[model samples]
Target chain A: MAEIARLAGVDTSTVSRALAGSPRVTKETRALIDKIVHETGYVVNETARHLRGGRANQILVIVSDIAAPFYSDVVQGIVETLAERGINVLLGVTLRQAKREAQLAKQLLTGVVDGIITVTGSIPKPVLSMPGFERKVLAISRAVPHEGVTCVTIDNCAATRQVMQHLHQRGHRRIVYIGGPNYSETYRDRRGAYADFMRENGLAELARMRATDSFNDDADSGFHIMKSILNEGDRPTAVFCATDELAIGAMAAARQADQIIPRDISFFGFDDLKLTPLMSPPLSTVSVPRFEMGRRGAEALFRQVYKDAPSSSKVVLDHRLILRDSVATIV
Target chain B: MAEIARLAGVDTSTVSRALAGSPRVTKETRALIDKIVHETGYVVNETARHLRGGRANQILVIVSDIAAPFYSDVVQGIVETLAERGINVLLGVTLRQAKREAQLAKQLLTGVVDGIITVTGSIPKPVLSMPGFERKVLAISRAVPHEGVTCVTIDNCAATRQVMQHLHQRGHRRIVYIGGPNYSETYRDRRGAYADFMRENGLAELARMRATDSFNDDADSGFHIMKSILNEGDRPTAVFCATDELAIGAMAAARQADQIIPRDISFFGFDDLKLTPLMSPPLSTVSVPRFEMGRRGAEALFRQVYKDAPSSSKVVLDHRLILRDSVATIV
Candidate 1:
C-alpha cells in the first residue's frame, strides 16, 4: 500500500480507499490505483486491511450441509463480505458425520485455510482436546466449549424461555417441548431452557410432556411425535419446537389429526425458515438472523486472521419474535 | 504400476486389484498395498484405474444454488462416488447469478478441476461461445445445445408424456402445466412435451395453460402463474408442475383458496423432494434418481478428462412415478 501510494503521489489511506473501491474515492483515482496494482502485481494484505489475521487472506466457513435450509443465507453473507477484501472462502460440509468432520479437521492442519468457522459440532472431542488448536478454530451458531475459540450464536436459552413465557401468558398450563438430539449445543440449550423455565413458572407437570429427538430435523418426526402426544388423554394447550423443520412437521401432524393451529392448540417454533411464511397458517417463530450470523462468523474469522486480534469475543446477532398466526392469544 | 507390483512381490494386475479394493483381492494383499502407498505416497490415477479417467483425480460439481433443496442430493451422490476414488471435489455455487457465473468460468480456465459438471445451464451462452470451453463442461438434469458438452439428464419428455397419459386416462379433459424459466432444459422439455402430448391426444383446449420466465429462474414465478390460471374460469381438473418447489407453492395457494388436493382437483409434481412424501396426502409425483444423475455426471466428466474421450452421448437416468394420494382416480 505504501509503495502504491508513493507511485500514485497519494497518501497510504487514499491508496487503501482507492484499492477498496470506496465510494469516497474519485473514479479516476480508483482506476489509476487498480492499473498500478495490475502493473506491479500488488497483492494487498487482506487480513491486515480487514483486521483478522495479520495477512493470511483466507478463512474456512464450515457448515454441516450446503443444501440444508439453515445455512445458505449465512454462507451467502460470509462470501459477500469476504469477496471485497480478495479473501477467498473454502466451504466444508461435514454432512453431520463424525468421520467427515475429522477428515476436514485434518485437512485444516495443512495450513490451506488461515482460520476455520464451523457450524457443525460433529468433530471428535479428542481433537479439540489436543494442544495447539487455539485461536485457529471458531464456532458459528454452535459451541465447542473451548476457552480460546469464540462463537456467534443466538440466545437459545433465552429464546426458549420466551417461548415458554408466550405459552404461559396465553393461558396454557400444559406445554410440550419437542427437541432434537442432546449432542448439539442448540438442542442442549433449548432443552435446558424448557426444563428451567417450566419449573420456575410452577408448571412442573408440563415437564413430563417433553419429547427428545422426536424431530430428527424432519417434518415426519414432528408428525409422529404430535400423533403420540394427541393420542394421550391429557394434551398441552401449546407446543414449542426446537427448529422450524420440527415445527412444520408437528403442524402437518396436527392438520392430519383434524386439529387447527392456534385454535385448539397454539404452537411456537425457532429458526424462522423462509418457507415458514408460506405454511398454511404462517408459523410463529424466533427469527434467527442466519445471514448476519454467517456474515459475522466470516468477518470474525477474517479479523482473527488479519489483525491477530483477541479470539475470545463472542458476538450475538439479534433474533426477533415473528408473531405469526400460529400462536393463539388465548389469554 | 510396475513399481507397486515389484515392491509388493505381486503381479501388476494384483497390485491394481488391491488398490481398487476389489473383493477378489485378499484382505492381506489390500493391507500390503495400503502400507506401500503410505510409505511411497503412491497416488492412484483414479480415472485410469477405474478405466474412466486414467489420471484425473479431480472432479468439479457446480450447482445453481449450493443451498437450494434441488441440488443437495445430487451433490451428495457426486461426493460419495468421487471420495471412494480418493478424488477431490471443487464445489462452486453460482447462486443463479450471471456475473458470478462468468467470474467462476474464468477460474475454470485454470484447469483446476479435472472435469466440470453443472446441475443446470449456468454459464451464459456468450461465455460458452468463447474458445477453449468446448471439451470440459457437462450438464446434469439439463441440456445445452452445444457440441462437445456431455448431458446427463432424466427423460423429461418421456416422463411428461407419461404424466399426461396418466392424467388423460383418468377421465380428466382439462389439464394445466406450470413450468420454470425458458433457459432451463428440464422446463423446456416438460413444457414442449405438455404441448405436443396434449395436441396428440386431442386435448388442445387445456394446453392454453403454460408458464415460463422471460430470462430468469425463480419458483415464485411459477406460483404466480398458477394463481392466474386458478383465477380464470374453467380450471383444469389436473395440474402438472415442472418442479416440486413450484408445485409446493401452487399447493399452498390452493390450500389458501379452500381447494382440496385431488378431491377438488388433481395435481402432479416432479422432483419428489424429501419434503414431498411428508406433505399432506403425499404429493403424487415422479421421482428423479438425482443421486444417480450426479454420480453418472461425475463419471462421464472423468471419462472425458482422462481418455480425452468425446462423451457427446447423453445419458438418461431413471425416473419413477410415485402413486401417492395427491392424484385421485378421476373415474
Candidate 2:
C-alpha cells in the first residue's frame, strides 16, 4: 500500500480505499493508482479490502424503470453529484415489480454497496426492517413513512391542488384524474388530494382509472388507458394525469380522435419531463425539479455514507403548475 | 464445498461459483444459499471464494447516455437477459465524454468486471491492446472494427436505404440528413449510405449537417439545428435524423416557426423510440429491435463468460421502415 501510494502520488489511505473500491477515492485517483498497480502486477482482494475499509465507495440506486425519462433525469443528477464525491452508483430498475424490489433489497445484505437511494416504495417492510436497512436506505420521490427514514419528495398534495385550481378557474366542471398504481405513496398523495379537492368543490370524481397494467411511466400503457377513456363517451371536460406519460398518451388519443386540444377538451399532467415541453401543444403540467431533487437526494445518501449519520427526516421540495397550450380555458 | 453444495441442493462448482459471485450461479440458488449461510452464521471469505472460482458473475456495460430512452431500452434488454442467466450487471454512462470512456476502459485492467459490453465506440485502441481485452469485450450498436472483436448491430446501411427509399418514393427530392458525431461508426454507416443513395439517383447530397454542438440525442440541441436549417431559406422537402430525439427537436423548431410537418416539410427519424409514436405527427422512422439487440449482445457476452469461448462473431439484426403521419406524399 505504501509503495502504491508513492508510485501513484496519492496517500496510503487513498491507495487502500481505491483498492477497496470505496466511494471515498475519486475516479482519477483510482485510475492513476490502478494503472500503477497493473504495471506492477499487484492483485487486490476486493472483499478483504472492503472488509477493512467498510465501504466500497459504491452506492445502489433502485428505480421503478430506467427507460422512463422521468427517472433518467433523476439518475443523471444522482450520478453527477456522486461522481464528484468519488462515489460510483450501481443502478437497478424494478419495472414496478415488488418481487424484483424485494430481490434487490435482499442483494443489499451482500454489502457491495455502502448505501442506497430508492425511488420506488414498494420495497417490503420485512426487507426495510432488516438490521442494516434503516441506516443505509434513503427514499426519494416516493415517500416512505417509516419513522427516522429520510425521504426527499415534492409537495404532492399542493401540486395536485394547483392543477385542480388551474382547471377550476378555467371553468371546467367535469374533471377526471388519471393516477398510477394505488400502492405508491406518491399516488396516494395525488389521488387523495384530487378526490378531496373535487369533494370540496361540489364536483364528483367519476373517471379515475388504475391498474390496466402496473406500468406508471410507460406511454404504451398510458395510451391504452387514455384510449379506453376516450372510447367510452360522456368524457369529462378536462383530464389531469398523475404523470406526463399518461397525459402525452391521452394527447395522442385525442389527435387520433381528430379533436383539437384546448378546443375540444383540456388536459394536464405532472413531472413536466423534457418531452412534455416538445409535445404538440406543449403540455400543461406541474413541474417538479427532477434534476435538483436527484442531486439533493444523492447528497442526503452521501451524508450517511460520509458522516455515518442516521437521518430519518422528511424533506419536501416545492412544485409549480406550468400552464401551456394543452389546457383549454373554457370561455 | 461438497457439504455446502449438498446443503444448498446444487453441485460443488455451483456452490463455489455462487460463493464467488460468479454469473454461473443462478440468482435463486445464490439467494437460497445466502439465506442458508446467514441462518447458519456461516462465514464465506469472498476473496478466497473468488480465488477458488476464478470468475465474477458480474459484467460491465458502458453506454453513451443513460437518460436517452434509446439506450435505456437496450439496457433493459441486457439486464433482463443477463439476470435470467444469474449474471449481475455494472453499468457506466459515458455521456459522450472521451475522457470518461478512457477512465472506464482503464478500470477494466483491475479485473473486477469479467467482461464488457460497450454500447458506444470511441474506446481508445491503446487500452484495447492491453492484455485480457480481446475475449471479454463486445461492441454493440457502434461498430468496433478491431480484428477478432465481436460486434452486434442492426443493418445500418439497409435501414438508411429504406429511409431514403421511403422519402424518394414519397416525392421528396430535397432531403436533409441530421447525423450524429462524425466519429461514431453507426453515424458513418448511416451517413455514407444516405450519401451513396443520393449519388446513385443523381440527387444532390448538399444538405448534411454535422458538429452543431456535437449533441446526438438532445431535443434542445436538435431544435437549434433545425431552426438554423429552416432559417436558411432553402429548407429540404424532408429531414431524416439518426435518432428520434433529433426528429422530435426538429418538430419543436418547426412548430415554433409555424410550419406544419408534412404540410410545409416532411420529417423522418431512426430508432423509433417509444416517444416517437406519441409525438404530434407520430414520427415516421425505422424500427430497430432495440430490446432484442440488447438481449442478444448480452447473451453473446455470457457465452464467452461461461464457456470462455474466444468468439468474435459479427451479428446483424433487421430493421424496418415505419410509415407514420409525419410524412405526406405530395399530390
Candidate 3:
C-alpha cells in the first residue's frame, strides 16, 4: 500500500480509497492509481484481507424462493443498491426449508459474509444465539420477533384493512379471504386484520376464509382452492387473495367456471406485479413498494454493518391500493 | 481437526468429510463428529482455506436481469444443484450494463468466487484472457464465442424452424416475427432461423419482423411495438414472439384493439412461462427446458471445476412447441 502511494505521490489513505473505488478520489487520481496498479499487477487479496478480520465486502441476501414472482424485484433492488457501493451479494435460497436456512445462517455467522439481509421473513433460531449476530442481521417484508434484528416492511395490517374497507364500500357483503401459508407473518397479519375488520363491521357471519397449503401459495394452489369454493355452491361477492399469483389463479378458475370477472365476482390482490396491469381486466391490487423495500433493507443493513447504527430500527414504507378494472362497484 | 477426530475416535479424513457434509460418512459417525465440533466450538476457516489456494466452494451465477421471468427457474435450478453439493451460489445481475459485467468478471478473476456461470450470453473480453478461465467458466442459454467455456442451450434454429413450420402447416401465410434485443445471441439465432425458413419456403415477401429496443424486451415493450404495428395498418394473420412476456403484451394490445384471439389473429411465444397457461386464451409457446438448462450448466461447470474435465463441450437440449388456445387452425 505504501509503495503504491509513494509511486502515485499521494497519501496512503488516498491510495486505499482509490483501491476501494471510493468517490473521494478525483477522476485523474483514480486513473493514475488504476494505471499503477495495472502495471504492477497489485491484485487486492480479498481472502487475505478477510483473514485479517477486514470486511469481506460481501453480504448474503437470503430468500425462500427465487422463482416466486414477488422476490425478483426485491432481490434486484438489493443487488443494484449494494453494487453501487462495491459490495457483492451472495444469494442463498432456502426454498422455505429449515435445514437449508440453518446451513446458510452458519455460513453468515462463520465469516463467509460480512452480514445477512434476510427477505425470507424468518431468521433461523440457531442464528440468533450466535454472538454479535444482532449487529449483522436485517429482515425485510416480515418483522422478526427478536429485538436484535432490524426490519423493513410495509404495514400489512393497514394494507389489509384498506382492502377490506374498499370491498365493503363497494357493497361486497360476502368477501372471501384466500390467504397464503400461516408461517408467513405477512399473511398472518393480513388475515388478522381481515378478521378484525369483519367482526368490527358486524359482517362476521359473511367472513369466510381459506388458506393455501404451507409453503404453497402459487397460482396453482389458488386455482385448486377457488375450484373447491366454486364446487361448494357458496358464491362470494368478492375474493381477496394474499398474492397476485393467487388472484390470477382464482380468476382463471372462475373463467373456467364461466364466471365473468367483476360482473360475477370481484377480485383483489396484494403486490402489484409488473404483469398485473397487463391482465385482461387489469388486476386491482395493493401496490407495495417491493423494490423500495429491498433498497431500504440493503441501506439499513449497510448502516448497521458499517456505520455502527442501531440494528433494532423498524422502517415502515408506504403502500397504495390500486383499484383497477378487476374490482366492481356493486350496489 | 486432530482434536475433533481424536475425540470422536475417527480418522482425520472422516472428520473433514463430515465437516464438509459429505455423504460418504455414516449418519452415526456424522452425528458424533457434529457433537464433538459443537462441544469444541469448531468453525471451518473458509478464508484460511482460500488463502491456501483451496476451493472457495462458492460460484457466481451472472444474469442480465433477475426480474425477466425467464431467469427465476434457471437460477433456482442452479442454486438447488449446487446446494446439494454443499456449494454456495453468489448471484450477480449485470442488468445488461457493460461496466457491471466487467466489474463482476473482475471479481470472478480475482478469486472471490471459485468459478462463474454466465447466463448473460456474452462474457467480458478481459475475463476471456484470464489464466485458467477455461476451467472455471460455463455459459447457459447463450453460447460464448470463445472456445474455452462450455455452453448449455437449446437448439434455437431447430426451435424456430418448428414454430415457423407449425404456423405454415396451419395455413398461415403472413406470420410476423416479434423479436427481442439483437444483443442477445438467442434472439439473433431465432431471427436468423425465421429468415432462413421464410426464404426457403419462397415466402420472402411475407417475412416481416419487428424487434424491441436494446435491453427492452418486457411486456410493455411488446405492447408499444404491437400498437405501432396496428397503427401502421399491417395486420398479420399470426405473430411469433421471442418471449412469453412479449406475446402476452401483444395479446393485451390486440384485446385493446378489439381483436379476439385466434378468431382474429393467432399468437405463438417462446419460453412457456408459468402464467402462460392462465392467460384467457392460454398462450401457445415453445417449452424450453429452462430449469434443466441451469441444472446442466451448473453440472458442466462443476465437472470442470472439480474433475478437471474439458471445458469446450456444447450441450444442446430439446425444445417442444406447445399448441394451446392462442393459435388457430385456419383453413
| Tens digit of per-residue lDDT, candidate 3, span A1-331 | 6788899999988988998889899999999998998887666656776787666788998898898888988999999999888888888899888899998887766678889988887787767777788779998998877777889999999999999999999999889999998888999999999999999999999898899987899999999999999998879989999999999899989988999898999999999999998887789999989889989999989988988987766889999999999989887
Candidate 2, position B315, lDDT: 89
What digit string (tens of lDDT, one per residue) describes model 3 on residues B10-42? 998999899889999999999999998998778
lDDT of 1 by residue, A156-245 (tens): 988888878877887877788888777788888998999898899887766854454522666667778888899985877788998888
Alpha-carbon runs more than 4 Å astray in model 1: A1-59, A80-88, A122-133, A209-215, A307-309, A329-331, B1-58, B124-135, B212-219, B306-312
Candidate 1's TM-score? 0.79
* Model 2 local distance difference test score: 0.79
Top-scoring candidate (lDDT):
3
Give model 3's docking category. medium
True contacts kept of each: 0.16, 0.37, 0.73
Native-to-model Cα distance after best TM-score fit, residue A18 in candidate 2, in Å: 13
Instruction: Please give, for residues A1-331, the per-residue lDDT of candidate 2 as tens digits.
Output: 6788999887988898887799998889999999998787665555445556666667778887777787878887888788778676777777667777766664455555677788886455435655656667888898776766788889999999888988999998788777777777888888889888888888755535444366454666667777787888887788888889888887788888888886887889899988788888899999999888889999988987678777868888889888899888887
Candidate 3: regions farther than 4 A off: A1-36, A40-42, B1-36
Better candidate by DockQ, 2 or 3: 3
